[model samples]
Target: MSVVPAEVLPGGARAVTGTVRATVTAELGPRARLWPSLVAVYRAQLSRARVARIPLLFVATFQSVGILIMMRGVVDGGSEAESVVAGSAVLVVAFVALNLLAQYFGQLRASGGLDHYATLPVPPAAVVLGAAGAYASFTVPGTLVTAVFGCVLFGLPLTHLWVLAAVIPLAGAALSGLGAAFGLLAPRPELATVLGQLGMSAALLLGVLPPDRMPEAVRFARDLLPSTYGVEAFARTFGADPDWALVLGDLAVCAGVGVVSLAVATWAYRRAAVR
Candidate 1:
């Protein structure tokens, strides 16, 4: 018996009878079937992530409350508009960054989850998508909570609201990609946590604090953070103003990080131990 690869097309037709065609047709099956399968994989992966990250979620919730308390004091004396804008913008970035750190560590555990994917026939992109999806579920919702609290506490407007919603998920994707990339540089899980802390501290010193207040060198260093633009996006949303240039720039940075980090992650993952 001869084994030949055949790609079946719609209507009992064959799209490719040759060596497995490189082209994957998304339209081959009924449209409804593809998404649920992909989403199921994503959900399964996310469940593992969620299970491992209960402590992280608890900590983030506590941190969010603490920051809200701090911002309440700090936002005093500012105009209502300015207070909400400033508070929400800063907190949103912090929230997203923390979420990224949590998700990165979840993935970093070397817990054989990464290995399981290595054996699957599923595409690598699917793996990345699933992992990112799982993390996004955690991070994106927190931003909403942060935003609403900012609004109620500081009178931040939800005008141009869709932009606010968009920023969270966009930041989520970018941060998850960055997390995968950072995971490559960190060889150990503990090291990853330390590095994430140091990185966020740096981001906070630069983005949360005004640059004018920082020494030149410290301010200069803040330019390296991926969360800066996301913070700006949050601020812009509060103002109901769209900075198209900033949006494009953020999108480009996200694309660059996702592509480069995925490459590095894939290589590093190949070397990752799987039991």
Candidate 2:
């Protein structure tokens, strides 16, 4: 058999080479489906966060519980008590989903961790959603404890407490997206932490404090806050006859803001990844 010259390959050999090149290109191309990558990222994020975040979750729950205890001394009942309880419950979500997530992403960015993710075939949305989902997941136990504890402390009926099931996720998504955006957009990790802290403080004050107590200016600012909708949604449930329509509207607003914020975070992730 005669060996073929390198530059004068037969048609069959050329076709085979072309087929192999196409196969390699297809194998090396970007991922098409996002769900599998999203799930993998979510699981990885959840596992990494579980151990490191437990203590912070404890602190978040404790802080909200402590707030309820303090409010117990001042407000015995009425709308003020309801506001305090609802605000405190949502605060747990803000602490972890917002504050801690910002810090995590900020530090991750600052430490060049994005390089690792950037090299992967995963979609940018998956990283943002996975991290946000994982952080938001941590808020559940804390939020539930805070809500139940606040309800018992204030003598509120548990009948409407079920509203928290909707409140936590809607509120967590908004807050988590905001946190991720802050972390990804900030110039430094320290700034991200500061932004997170300030955001949480705003949620605590504007959300927990009765709207009646806030000045017109402060109340206007509160109205602009995404968590305000969540607070209103949760607080309205405490009443004997809640306007379910209004409660759902508030939740819808929260859901909308959550979508917008997550979109922004995804953009921020892409921007940061390219940097």
Q: Judged by TM-score, which candidate is best? A: 2
Instruction: Give all TM-scores, in the order shown.
Output: 0.69, 0.89
Q: Per-residue lDDT for 89-111 in model 2, tens only?
A: 99999999899999999999999
After superposition, the stretches of candidate 2 with alpha carbons farther than 4 Å from their true spots are 1-32
* lDDT (10s digit) by residue, model 1, range 1-275: 44544543354465667887698667543323435555876887678656776676556555655666675765562343343343344444444344354346445544546665666555555555566657656665555666666566766666654665666655556666556545544666666666556655655455555444568777567566666666665555555556777766765665565556555554555555343
Q: After superposition, how far is residue 28 of candidate 2 from its true place, in Å?
A: 2.4
lDDT, residue 63, candidate 2: 96
Worst 10 residues of 2 by lDDT: 17-26
**Candidate lDDT values, in order:** 0.56, 0.92
The count of backbone overlaps in candidate 1 is: 0
Q: How far is each candidate from the true structure, as Cα RMSD in Å?
A: 11.6, 7.4
